[model samples]
Target: MAVADLLALINEVILNWIRLHYFYWANWCGLSTCTTRYLVAMAVADLLALINEVILYWIRLHYFYWSFLAIYPVCSVNDVLRYAATDCSVWFTVAFTFDRFVAICCEKLKTKYCTGKTAAVVLATAGVLFCLKNIPRYFTQKPGTIIDNMPWLCAMVASYYTDPGWVAYDWTDTVLTPLLPFAVILLLNALTVRHIIVASRVRKGLRGESKGENRSDPEMESRRRSMVLLFTISGSFILLWMTVVVDFVYYQITGIGNNLNESQWIFTCVGYLLRNLSCCTNTFIYAVTQSKFREQVKSAVKYPLTSVLRRINKSPS
Candidate 1:
């Protein structure tokens, strides 16, 4: 069964159970409440998917079969998690892109308009939209469907591979969602680059000195670093998504290129593993490439460590 179907099935089962035994929980949990729970659940799912992918990749690289059975459950859960994570990721990416757009384009109005309250509202709105968009699939189930026929270990949504609605969903997911953010980022990057170049030239002209003499200007250096980081992340985003697009196209055009019947389990598992890895790669890139992010992470860890050290130093030895 495809990941989406498995997720839909799992979501259906969970929702049904919640409705049956936990009526109070359901009543008290509004859309925002459910969405928050879903987002956290999706993050956990993505983490599991990452681990499963790493293990599967290791096994495949080493040509191991002994661990296959043991890893099956991990792989299955990974798929369901992947579906949930993908949905959460889409919403999060939209939020991130919008945040960047506002930060870059509306610098003057940011303090007044883009406060934490505004961000929270935007996130809540996105969560609602994402849930509503995907809610239809939960009700559209059939007996012996793709998800039902899968291993009986756990309930999962079946893949609606042949469903016409899926094609529409694919367009929305693969084309519209990423492309919109990408376009906005590209435009902002271009404008920022152009502004920096113009400012550098003007500063050099006003200095009554050769451009080479002022090449080490602090402002110019900062701008250069900022541009480099922006381009690096933008490039990574494009590359990561391009791989997904290529994979989707290949699947649609060639109808499972690698003989699924012969290599059914391994091929499906590996493909999913790679896709999940691609999604997780962004977090690493941000940590490694962005100086501001690195500093924040350092401070986050160092503050606690420093307090502990101070307490130890003040205590009787």
Candidate 2:
């Protein structure tokens, strides 16, 4: 677990730093401003998720046993913030998917809906809504332990399991997150793929490819690049979150809260592990799918060593 924490911490910090710089400062990646904003938003959300979900939780749980954050009200607030970050990270991917779907399939509407202004508005609206939605989560926590007249750690209030309101909220929260995002991304990607296939055939016919005239179709090439970027990012997200999606269904159907058997316990833990891992994967996806992104990453990597060498050469030795 310590190693896992260290790796996650390192990955989130380093990769997101690189991603932020590449997406924000460099236009070499050839992505539109709207797409850049979505990527930046996702990176920021992933960093916050790592800080709240992994770093802060780790300190409270293991290293700093009596940390104030583990206390009742503080713990509840932490839980709320964590959920908000997770929701933002998950939904940003959905936003990016929908943006791509519009650009690829709905050409007429794309000009209006897929601008930087629209991206900002959509992200702000979603962020505020999710933050507000998760406020009720703060009430669902209780002290996990009482020691020397002090409450420490957080546990779900018993009523969260039994009360109708809390139960319904729980279901809604789960559905609003990975489950709904999962379905929506899959549907959007499916439609996008179908559109690409039909469009490709039409394009080849119009270009005289059926009569054996070979030519470079710049339009199709552009669409292929967009499809590559879209599919890699969304595909990584779906694959990583698949376990969590399944575990949610299992938990709801079985209603097995505390008495999970060995296999079930492991399964639940693995789902959580993968969910945390999802926060660190998009930078890799970008590197894999975008050649310009790879060039930028390599330059970013070499800049430090290059700077040091330049400094040594200029020194009076």
Candidate 3:
């Protein structure tokens, strides 16, 4: 393998292992909440996506960019799974944001809709929908002769591989995947914040009447926890996804991606890197926010290491 391929392989393998660890640990010993059922689904989808992406990266390294630089009409299993996972991850965040919106903005709907079972159903449905949605993308890859002069034709492949037939679904995916959800999240969070403030003021108004009662209601505490989690999720999603949204919009407006300048190519790479990293960050978010998650991780780590140390000492004696 070339140096580039080796580096790519190492980086991908390391990230995927961490991602898998996060998923395995969180699902196995840490995560246990109705509200976070989406995390379980996200972790599963992320691991599958990351694994397939590593495969695709390996193929691209060996076959397309390395040797067979002249093949056209290329359809790849990698592209299919990549598109599906990318879409699934985006939609899951949207569904989660919608859940938060309802829970904060409308109590009646929250009661009816935002259950663990409901979240599981929504996630399962999203996984199936995205898998079906990107089926068209399976036939979308076609090798194009954009940069026949570059060493590996990196810029051209970036543009051509993304040209998954600019059909209705593509258009919708472009808009709704991150753009619409981003907008809705912003709007909903604004409403949620407003709701929270108003509710706080009302609580103050009732301070005299409820002087005997504790200020921290359990329902209110639950809301606060969910809000914290949502903010963390949304913050990272925005930070990572903003680049993609900008890249897509720039492509739509200027159509200059196929022959991207050096800086634009760099920007594209950074955006994609951020998107790939998004899958790994959620597990960290859970670890940071949930005591249960942290405790489980500590126990998981300590017990194994202690056992290994004990065996080492015993063998030496």
Ranking by TM-score: 2, 3, 1
Clashing pairs in 1: 5-157, 5-158, 5-159, 6-157, 9-156, 9-157, 10-157, 147-158
What root-mean-square deviation over C-alphas does model 3 reach?
Answer: 7.5
Per-residue lDDT over 101-162 for candidate 3, one digit per residue giving the tens place of the 0 to 100 score? 88787988877787878887888888888888877664555444445653222222343435
lDDT scores in order? 0.52, 0.85, 0.70
In candidate 2, what are the lDDT values of residues 22-53, reduced to their tens digit? 55434767678888788888877887787788
Per-residue lDDT of 217 in model 1: 79
TM-score of each: 0.54, 0.85, 0.71
Question: Which regions of candidate 3 are displaced past 4 Å?
Answer: 1-33, 58-75, 143-169, 209-217, 294-317
Off by over 4 Å in 1: 1-81, 139-163, 177-184, 206-209, 215-229, 254-271, 290-317
Compared to the true structure, candidate 3 yields what TM-score?
Answer: 0.71
Top model by TM-score, which number? 2
Error of 1 at 269 (Å): 6.0
Collision count of model 3:
0
Q: What is the alpha-carbon lDDT for the whole of candidate 1?
A: 0.52
Give one digit per residue, the lDDT tens place, for model 1 in 171-208: 66555545666676677777777767777778888866
Model 2 clashes, total count: 0
- lDDT for model 2 comes to 0.85
Report how far residue 3 has shifted in candidate 1, in Å: 21
